[model samples]
Target: MHNDPSNENGILHSWQQNAEAWTNTVRDGLIESRRLVTDRAIVDAVLDGQPRSVLDLGCGEGWLVRALATRGIQAVGVDAVPALIARASERGGEFQVASYEDIAAGRLPLRVDALVCNFALLGKESAERLVASLPSLLSEDGRFVVQTVHPLVACGEQAYVDGWRQEGWTGFGTAFPSPAPWYFRTLASWVGLFAETGWHLCEMREPLHPETGRPASVIFILQRH
Candidate 1:
């Protein structure tokens, strides 16, 4: 499959195809990474900023939106995949079907106090374009928080570089198929991308897993002064 997200078999297409299975997997607690560590890590990171309104970019099934709602924080979930957004809407969240292209083009009408992208940035060009377009979508004091698989740990045997990586639905079940290849970015690249887009890295959190004590994900809290 082509590494570009615009391709028919790219990351967005794969998510659209497997939205149901992905929703089930998430709701069922089948993935140990989210079940144990990353999910709460992201939720807590978002809440810590105390934003009244939050935008969950690439939010799947609106889980985070629903979670934040319990605490009286208004949240909206947006994704490029219509199926995922539809599933999220069915779950009673404020969701809209909007691609990164749509967002980058300033189609989003509201500016949010906080924006969260949890393991959702998959393509190289999309990531950069999306980040570059975020300042206008955020309030003056808004924060952009992103949580991704720790690059150092996730790299494994692959050479450390920014390129297309063969996706491994590692430890996932047979129900999930046609896993799409994702762009692999180094930690430095992540920081560089943010910096180049006028975002200052305020805090970086590596939440540890209880069992292995390994950093499960890296959370970057970015701010613009």
Candidate 2:
């Protein structure tokens, strides 16, 4: 949770090291909640808008990009981890290696009708900068969509106060690599973030697990104001 220079490096290192393991596990349906609920929520939100081209920020393993392709939507996937991007490239989609800072600085050269960040807005600094840059990243009428772990469920035993959180590798077994750091923000803070960025929250929904009835993730569909 420490906001030091090493934190970002640590996160990238962990993901890089764990890319193949993470990809293999996710592809094999290791996380049932994501496979069943959150994944569908993200795809449905984008399809409902019917965007011609989509930019998937921090798209891991290119699963979502592949899914979108099957639906006739062109998606460009970008991630900081080279290994993940490589795996994504092998999946037959346009994948790029760009950090969140690259996107914030307008270094990534592309524009799309919609941008999706699926469980990828990990840190406060990057998240803030990225939100501020969304106006330039999307088309005039494009939407910014993000699906994240529901604060209520994500908070679990931790304090609701916004801060750094080292992910628990418990669910992925020992084969998983280093734990990554992510910021935990309350629902109120999430709302405030978009509002400060001059983006309006046009739609919001909590994707719930059909069998357990527990919310898996929260989707926020936003528009430039």
Which numbered prediction scores highest in lDDT against the true structure? 2
Error (Å) of candidate 2 at residue 137 is 1.4
Model 1, stretches more than 4 Å misplaced? 1-9
- In terms of lDDT, model 2 sits at 0.89
**Per-residue lDDT of candidate 2, residues 54-119 (tens digit):** 999999899999999998988999999998999888869889999998999999889899999999
The superposed Cα distance between candidate 1 and the true structure at residue 96, in angstroms, equals 0.8
All predictions: root-mean-square deviation over Cα? 1.7, 1.2
> How would you encode candidate 1's per-residue C-alpha lDDT over 9-92 as one tens digit per residue?
477777877788888888888989899999999999998999999999999888999999889998999998888888888879
The candidate that achieves the highest TM-score relative to the unseen native structure: 2
Q: How many residue pairs clash in each candidate?
A: 0, 0
What lDDT is reached at residue 72 by model 1? 97
lDDT of predicted model 1:
0.87
> How does each model score on lDDT?
0.87, 0.89
